[model samples]
Target chain A: MKENNSFILGIKHGIPICLGYLSVSFAFGIFAVGSGLSVIEALLISMFNLTSAGQLAAVPIITGGGGIPELALAQLIINLRYSLMSVTLSQKLGKTVSALDRFWIGFGITDEIFAVSTSKNKSVGRKYMFGLILTPYAGWSLGTLLGSVAGNILPDSVSSALGIAIYGMFIAIVLPTVKKHLPTALCVVGAIAIGCAFKYIPMLSRVPDGFVIIIAAVVASMVAALLSPVSDEESEQTDEKEVNTDA
Target chain B: MPSMNFFFHLGVMAGITYLVRMLPLVLVNKKIRNRFLLSFLYYVPYAVLSVMTVPAIFYATSSPWSALAGFVIAMILAFFEKSLLTVAIFSSAAVFVTEFLLPIIQ
Candidate 1:
């Protein structure tokens, strides 16, 4: 009964993620089809990969006649955050979780999934994670299929307008956190400075987009973490407990 | 006009993508606890996001000057803690208007 309740909670929590994924994946599908991919091909890509940024980045590389190595490197750099997310989540899951469960859960470690999962109380278990993954996975895959089929039906202007949705989503993700954390605000400024420098400086401008992103992220994160060290007293208080399971 | 090769290319892309996604999971041991590493990991997403979004403020526009105007509008909206949807629409509209009106005025 407890397991069933956890599973239900997972599904309920996944609702917002599913809705967001549907809209974004639909846009991606339309863009992919507009870029000359067929419906099946687009749907297949979204289904298997489920990474909007990587997909967007890959689309241009593929179309621009970039080689396989270029595509792989671009994707590696763009989605490297997933590696961090996976590691943090594994620690959160702890010892009792089976290997097979970890395998399946690892597959669903997208930004939204990690956000929702980590935000949950420690009491939440693998069942809940599985349920959360199910709905968004379906929404993303199906939305891509639908959008691919519906491509070119909409006016180019409207399609171009919809291009802002992903940016809107990014703003939604970052703004709230930045408002609460001064370090985050500093990181944002640092990123802007670094990005602008890369764009304008002749030496940095020669660097590839993927490499630039990786470098900027690493440097900004390092600086932010260094400048705002967490207080040891607060860390000690939190570390005393195994996991705060209270929701 | 997607050719059969398109599907083949996508398949290759998917394979490569999955390999990248699966690597850290297979490699990173769950028991390892490095405070410095964890702290670094915590801020990565935010840094990556800022890096990605900051450039788009300029790249999305037709000209750098016009994009700067739009970016100013965005920064103002962001400073005031405006809604994301509102900020996005306002910033893009600012760019569109700037791009549209600048030539006429000049």
Candidate 2:
């Protein structure tokens, strides 16, 4: 009964994540198809790779016939942050959570899951974490499937317009926190400025989009972390713990 | 797209990404008490999302102008802390309308 309740709780909390992913992944689906992935390919991509940044970023590179190493490298850099989240969450799960549950649940620990799970002052159990990840997982997959199918049907002009959906989703995820937090706000501006520099500067322009994202994220984040290291007490809410920006 | 290469990339991307998550979860059984690393990890999401949004967004629309309009619309919605889906839908709709109206005016 308790497991079921937490499962339900996870779904309840995950509803917004599901809803948001449905549209953002819709954009990804269309973007994937627009970039030449088959509908099934797009769906599978969403299924296999749940996060938005790496999967969506990989599409252009993959479609352009980039190599396995390039794709692997992109996944590593983009998703590496999750490692920190996983470690953070692992402590929350604690010794009570079995090794088996820990392994499986880690798969679901995206930004939102981490944020929501960590937000609980009490330690989170296996069931709650599983429950939390479920809705967003379904939402992500379902949205991608729909988007892939829709991509085949939508006209180019409209599909092109829809392309902004992914970025819009990113903005919605980050903008609120950036507004509330000065360090986070600086981090956004700094990342964008670096990203733009890579694009316009002649020498840096040759860098692949994948490399550029990795470099910008790492460098800007490192700087911000130095400038504004959170006291240990304020860290949990500072997440990262959501699709709220967690995923 | 060649099936062989596609699957290869998929396998590698999924494999490495999974390892990234799994290692930390399974291995790091103890809680991190370190302030410095904790602070750094906290900033990761904001940085990642920010870098991912730009340059690429410019090309997601029929025109850069349309994308910019959508971005502006999204920023406004997000500033007021609207739901994610609301921000995305409204912004995309804004982009679609801008795209549609542009050719007529131009």
* Candidate 2 residue-wise lDDT, A1-247, digit = tens: 1222366777788887677677778888988888899988898788887888889779978888766666777788788878888887776774447888877887787776677777666677766777788888998998888888888898877787777888887888788888888888898899999999999999999888877787888888889888888876556555542345423
**iRMS per model in Å:** 4.5, 1.9
Total colliding residue pairs, candidate 1: 0
Q: Name the docking class for model 1.
A: acceptable
Residue-pair clashes, model 2: 11
Clashing pairs in 1: none
Candidate 2 CAPRI category: medium
What is candidate 2's DockQ?
A: 0.71
- Native contacts retained by candidate 2: 0.80
DockQ of each: 0.37, 0.71
Candidate 2 regions off by >4 Å? Answer: A1-6, A94-96, A240-247
